[model samples]
Target: MKIAVDAMGGDFAPQAIVEGVIMAASSLPADTQLVLVGRQDIIKELFQKHGFESSAVEIVHADDVIEMSEHPTKALSQKPNSSIGVGFKLLKEKAVDIFCSAGNTGAMHVGALFSIRAIEGIIRPAIAGFVPQVNGKHAIMLDIGANADCKPDVLSQFGEIGSLFARHTLHIDHPRVALMNIGEEEQKGSVIAQAAYQLLKENKRIQFVGNIEGKDLFTDKADVIVTDGFTGNILFKLGESLYGILKERGIEDEFIARTNYESIGGSPIIGVNGNVMIAHGISSPLAIKNMISWARQQVEANAYIHIAQALA
Candidate 1:
């Protein structure tokens, strides 16, 4: 399987991204093709510096780079040769099975939507990531940063999609699903959330576990949490901050090293027609390597196909 890496999108740019690509090319399965998408000259220099051949990691020349502040729609239209645009175009053409980037998150989302397009039944493509809870259990959070305003139907779809991901990817049977809310009562929060909660509670596809407050995030109360992108992103960042503080306290050496930003690598964007993994801007070589492995596993498991069928 071929995975395209955006070598110039992140804050660290070509340097860290190139190192990660080299590491993946060397350590990953021999058949896995690593397509490094970025400014060709700089990427080649990094490869040469590391004593790796250009053949080891294929270069997909992209003339422009999208700034983090640039709007996705604007970048896609104005900067056709940008890394985000070129990399996404490659995915659309089936040049690669997966597209990975540490670039502007908004640009990535917008580009993927137009490039790979969303599945037929999907209302909005959700950006999802697994948050580790107590006893190594994970809770899948959806709409982490995709769509902000969502209708009740959108939230219900998020729960359904998130549940499928937990079952197929994480091997969870009857994964408990919860709507992030202000209270445990059914009438709590905005009308949209309340209505969504009602539908989720009555839905048969997922094991709807009722409302989950922000405090319950790490309590092992739910395996999959669904919310609109606005709330989901807030909770995601909050969780990250909490984890950061925990690390700063120097709690557990093992968990600290394992759960750090550099270690976690990337988050997979679900609901799209293909695989697109988005990494942290500050991701290290190890994290990039992990992202490649994660993307390969998703392809091997046929996660996107399984999800497409499940959503259908």
Candidate 2:
């Protein structure tokens, strides 16, 4: 399998990204290759400065870069030679099994939709985030900043998408799917949630558990949580802030440590035709390395294929 890394995407471009690729190259399977997409000269210099020589690593030159503040659609169309743009091209051509970036989240989302497109029968693609569980396992949450406002049917499809993701990536058998709501009752939440509950309840693709409250996020009550992007994005950021606060207080614990974004690496843009992982903008070398591993795992699990089958 070949995984493409956007060497220019993150805040710590080229340097941290190159370091992470080197780290991943050392441990990755001999047959697996790491393709770095960015300026060829700079990448080679970093590789040499780091005293790394591996045939499994390749570099694809992309002269331009999409700035963090640039408009997603405009940057993609105007700068066809940008690292993110080139990476998507490679993905579309099947040159890489997975494409990952820690740069602009919006750009990545836009690129995925425009380049690879969504799976057939999928109303909208959802971004899946990992929620740390108390039992040392992880639960999957969907629609995390992908579609801020979704219809009831779209939310229900998020359940199926999240369920398939958990089953394939988390290796869960018959993963319990739950809708995030204010109360545990089916009739709770807004009109959309109430309507989504009925659709999810009748859907046989997933094991639909009733509603799951915010407090139940880290519990074993649900293996997959579905919610609108607006709510899920807020919750996702809150979790990140909580981790930062705990670390600032010098509090150390295994469960809290699991809350680190580095540990989770990145979130996958599921329901898309090809594999695309989007990491945090401030991702460190360790985070990038973990993202590569997560991407490889998804490919090995045949995640997209299973998701297509489930949606079908």
Candidate 3:
């Protein structure tokens, strides 16, 4: 399998990405290849700086770069040779099994939508975040930041896709799906939440477990947690912040260690046509290395194909 990574799309740019690629290349399977998309000269220089050379790693030249502050659509359209642009191009052409970036979040999201596109019958593709559970496993949370405002039907679709992702990718049989809300009761949240609850309950394809409150997020209450992007994004970030907050106080916990962003490295944008991972813009070399590992899992699972089949 080949995984394409945007080399010039992050805060640290070529340095961190190249170093991370080197770190991952050392441990990758012999059959797997890492494709670095960026300026060839700079990428090679960085590799030489680290005194590293590997046949497992290849560089794909990209003449331009989309700044973090640039508009996603505009940058992608104007800069076809940009790292993000070339990465998506390779994905669309099936040259790589996966494309990942720790650069602009909006650009990554847009690039996926405009490239291989969403799966058939998908209302809107959602970004799924891996939430660390108390049981030493992770729960899949949908619309983590993709669709901030979701209708009842859209929210219901999140449950269905989230369940499929959990089953195939996480290897959970009959995953229990739950809606993230203010209360555990049926009538607890806003009008949209109440409506979404009924829709999710009526859906037989998923094992809907009703609503779960914020307190139950990491308690292993459900295998899949459904929430609008607005709420889900806030909750996901708040959960991720535990590691930094606790570390500053000289506190170390086994479960808290999993909260570190570098552990998982990146979050996959589910319901898309192909594998696409979005890592934190502030991702470290460790995070990129881990991201590449997780990307392999995603490619092997091929959840998007299963999701498209299920929808059909």
TM-scores of the models, in the order given = 0.93, 0.98, 0.99
Provide C-alpha RMSD values for all models, in order. Answer: 1.9, 1.1, 0.7
Model 3 steric clash pairs: none
What Cα-based lDDT does every candidate model obtain?
0.84, 0.91, 0.94
Comparing candidate 2 with candidate 3, which one achieves the higher TM-score? 3
> Top model by TM-score, which number?
3
Candidate whose lDDT is highest? 3
Better-scoring candidate (lDDT), 1 or 3? 3
Reference-based TM-score, model 2: 0.98
Which of candidates 1 and 2 is the stronger one according to lDDT? 2
Compared with the true structure, model 1 gives a TM-score of: 0.93
Candidate 3 global Cα RMSD: 0.7
lDDT of 3 by residue, 1-312 (tens): 999999997888879989999999999999899999999999999998999999999999999999999999998899888999999999999999999999999999999999989998999999999999988999999989989999999999999999999999999999999999989889989999999999999999999999999899999999999999999999999999999999999999989999998999899999899999999998889999999999999999999999999999
Off by over 4 Å in 2: none
Top-down TM-score ranking: 3, 2, 1
